[model samples]
Target: MSTHETSAREEVDAIIAGAGGWRAEALATIRAVIISADPEIVEEIKWRKPSKPEGVATWTCRGNVCMADVLKKAVRLTFPRGARLDDPTGLFNARLDGSTVRAIDVFEGAQVDEGALRRLVLEAVAENRAG
Candidate 1:
């Protein structure tokens, strides 16, 4: 892996570890699912600042696929091109009103539809590659 990619992966690992409890587990699970969806997907740490220096956990193929943030009440997976992707299983539950993005909010004890999420990731990668 490239140096930046390695650093980003390490940053994500730190974020997940720092999250602790169910949030950590959820973020790890989400990361695994996203990676499994496409081997070309790249992990990134974006939007770093003093308030939240760890930044957001972002995944990209040819373009931005999604970003994960550990919220107080939920772990959010926001798809940048979600508006163009089909959601037959209706996995998206937040940011529905956005014109170009959609998000899935995973709260404590909530179950993620892995199959649907994998499909979405694949679709998002394809979308990125197409452009």
Candidate 2:
């Protein structure tokens, strides 16, 4: 590998090593979203995985449970206010046809639209903070 490629690989390895789990990338993504949206968001571990307080749905931004799901090749990011995003890219749940409710999911082998995810996270943080 070229020096640059080697350096990048080393950096990723270091990050993964320090990240502390098999779900490190997902954890990092979620944490980046939360921190960008609200630095004050309280993070705690529940059921041995990271959980955050989403407000209103069963796993609302203010609710006690913010869901985290990981699969053999990908991770899921489910938000409590998933139904409220100003924009939708068919990236959410199949069952949610309502205007203001659903789940944001990141699946394997498909590129997640980061902009959409950011908007969802931004809105979720706002919803939770408003509570």
Candidate 3:
């Protein structure tokens, strides 16, 4: 799929629909992180990801992948294979009790480590290839 083929709203409707208002905001966060890092991947909101590719794309394997969910106070960033990434930044330890796929919660005015999250996503993509 290409940008001329569809619009962002149409793409958002694909996965962000029925996700509620906060869902769009959560999607925005996930997107901001992904683009801020690797701004060159052929990103699209197919199923699991609304602003990026799911499973395999320009990189990675057919793994569980990452996702975000809206919460009462914040959005939870869940990486299904986070344990595989050797994160230099401690952006994923809060929601995770030392697990593979970890969650990073972000809320209003909360200082989110965008670079770190982006690194985590890229790392997950790289890990997919490693295995």
Candidate 4:
């Protein structure tokens, strides 16, 4: 990995480590699946603030593929170009009405279909590239 990538990874690691409990576990698991789906994917943290110390985790290729934020009730994974992607598995359960974005909100105790999520990520990447 490049130096910039390493720095970003370290920053994201600190964010994940600090988000203890289920949030931490969920972020780690979701991150692993995203990386597995695209080996060259770039990870970064955005929108940092005192209220939200961890900011949000964003993965991109050419442009944003998806971002995940740990909320009180669920982990929201949003795809900026999701409206254009074909979601056959119906994994997206949030932001359905948006004209450009769509999201999948994973609540606590909910089992994530990693296969479907990965497919969505791949499709999102394709959408990004096509733009």
lDDT per residue (tens digit) for residues 5-58 in model 3:
355435544444544566555657676666455434334333445543532112
lDDT of 3 at 124: 77
Give Cα distance to truth, residue 68, candidate 2, Å. 1.6
Better of 3 and 4 by TM-score: 4
TM-score of each: 0.97, 0.53, 0.62, 0.91
User: Which predicted model would earn the best TM-score?
Assistant: 1
Structure candidate 3, residue pairs in collision: 83-100
Q: How well is each residue in 1-131 modelled by candidate 1, as lDDT tens digits?
A: 99999999999999999999999999999999999998899999999999998999999988899999999999999999999999999999999999999999999998888999999999999999999
Error of 4 at 58 (Å): 0.5
Q: Indicate the residue-level lDDT of 40 in model 4.
A: 68
**TM-score of candidate 4 relative to the true fold:** 0.91
Q: What local distance difference test score does each model get?
A: 0.95, 0.50, 0.58, 0.86
> Per-residue alpha-carbon lDDT of model 4 for 1-131, expressed as tens digits?
88978887898788778767887888888888998898768998788899887677899998889998878888888998889988888989999999999999888888889999899998888777788
Would you list the rank order by TM-score, best first? 1, 4, 3, 2
RMSD of 3: 5.9
Lowest-scoring 10 consecutive residues by lDDT in candidate 3? 52-61
Clashing pairs in 1: none
